[model samples]
Target: MSDRAPQPVERQLPTEEARDLLALVRELAQREIAPTAAGEEDAGHFPREVFALLSRSGLLGLVYDEEYGGGDQPYEVYLQVLEELASARLTVGLGVSVHTLACHALAAFGTKEQRAEYLPAMLGGGLLGAYCLSEPSSGSDAASLRTRAVRDGDDWVITGTKAWITHGGIADFYTVLARTGGEGARGITAFLVPGDAPGLSAAAPEHKMGMKGSPTAQVHFDGVRVPDTRRLGEEGQGFAVALSALDSGRLGIAACATGVAQAALDEALSYTAGRQQFGRPIADFQGLRFMIADMATQIEAGRALYLAAARLRDAGKPFSKEAAMAKLFCTDSAMRVTTDAVQLLGGYGYTADFPVERFMREAKVLQIVEGTNQIQRMVVARHLAGPESR
Candidate 1:
């Protein structure tokens, strides 16, 4: 493990303000996040206070409209911030991404009244949020979700289970998708459900291979009722809203994967340079040097791929294909790079004494989360060859 702090990544920012924002993010990650990461993750402790601090610092909502208390930065800037945070702690970085996804439905599709009433607090007023889409039976096929919302008078009563929800038990609010009519994607509708809404409850958190500090649990809505006023977008438009949010959310995952891979690479470089082998530094060897070169190239390529996707999004161009590609390539690269980092460290990398082992475990989940690499390939293929026929 590297005792020294990892060097800051050289980012290409469009504005001085973005550069300042990145510097602040790096400082905060070093001072507040990195030091306690291993211990907290070992203890399975979620750092709620860290999120509150992020809210206070206006780091929670960088890409939304300033009118809603967001920083009004471009997506490119926001992703770089995510990368910095994830390098320090995956829980915090991925938590911010999920919160941003949770905010997307209402922020992008809600009426002005809804945004004015809810967006401010959700964005930067210290509230945490979760996006509820995948159910026990609906992972990749989110449109097949069975959580039903029945309308009675002016209110809708929700009933069903949402699985694999980050911030599931602890979120201040949840942006949920539920079945309102018929079946399939067209039947789904979006709702802003309070975390404390009646009959809403969360099961015990899932025991996971990694990211134990970040809660992932099953959230149940049993006759949880909210008024029609809480509905986001028109009925039957929820699937589109969810898909739109995911295009951006996948980019968030890509940035985090890059961050993790970079962290692993830094550790490998530090260890190889210091650990003596046959009376000389192991880094002096050709085989190890080639491995390090490959890792660095992968990290740089992943960063560039994600940033390219983000720029397209900021320009209001169609970017779903690129987002999928970035997510696919970056996460796959992270898995490979982290594994090599472990191999480079030899026996030491397999132990909890060093961070590389943990980084390897964390990298595994990135390949599976948001959308799996297989799913990402499907998404990219859809753009090229059209959707699969039933």
Candidate 2:
């Protein structure tokens, strides 16, 4: 063997291969997701069929391990696919992302036995997972969650409620964080509680301003039983696992934000190019042209930030701060971009006739979920100021 280090294959894909995948994803989004998205939102219907289609296409496991029947693709590629999906239907895109977050604990920290027992159904399209982190009393201050998991011989008896659980009523499983130690962050631990466990129930779906098709509810766990084997990692590891999952999950939200922005820009561009005003195309006006330019520029910047953060994570680098930054920046940018996109559409944008208003509604949740933008700021500040700063 030569003394020199072996050459590493390029992590980045060839341009042609990337383009082909993008084209395929875009086609799927347009052909499958776009057609029913408006009606689904209007009727408050979940597009269960769209998720089945995605599962059939292997998009659900895009960033998972190949051994588990995942696509084993890079996060960079996966995020781009998410962008396309959200551009068509944000509800589906976000639901997919949330499902992945709920599944993250088993994938990252599960024992080999646990992995073998659970990974297949989760990786396959047969099961969907929901992350349970937030509570009615504990939104940003997750460490103070009041949910309790008491050891009861071979099984743990969990009692308390998990609020704002995405897919709470519909998911096959829930990854719950509850107190197992004393109080505060150190006291928390994670458990893989099946959705059908006895004493587990979900409240009626929340009526939200946007992403109406996606369900959100409070999950009550009254003496829900989980085997000791279902405990994820060691006791008191819940906080770490939740934070780790959030770092990755934030990137997913950022990607969704980028997609929302891109969709708005594409719509604005198409409408302005042909929809005439002053007896000519309004796109020709310098003011309107400048607005479009700003939209495109901001979208590109946000995309770059999130992609860079994803790359860091895939490479096993410390990515928490970067992920928070990307999440905060991209979601904020999305709120601005989608609002501007509606403005570009003039009266039509404000009405249900165009998709811009819908996009705006969908964009708002991205900032609030995963971790609120305020929480994201706190996370970033902690990283910058060190442990001593108040």
Model 2 lDDT tens row, 1-390: 112321211224435766667778888888889888888898999887788777777778778887886778778888888888898899988888988898889888888899888877787756888999999999998999999999999999999999998898888899999999998999999999888999999999999999999999999998999999999988999999998899999999999999898888878887787777789988889998999899888888898899899889889899999999999999999999999999988998999988899999989999998899998998899899866443
- Steric overlap count per candidate: 0, 0
Any runs in candidate 1 off by more than 4 Å, and if so which? 1-5
In order of appearance, the predictions have TM-scores of 0.99, 0.94
lDDT of 1 by residue, 249-334 (tens): 99999999999999999899899988888999899999999999999999999999999999999999999999999999999999
Question: Where does model 2 exceed 4 Å of error?
Answer: 1-19, 388-390
Cα lDDT over the full model 2: 0.87
User: Which TM-score value belongs to model 1?
Assistant: 0.99
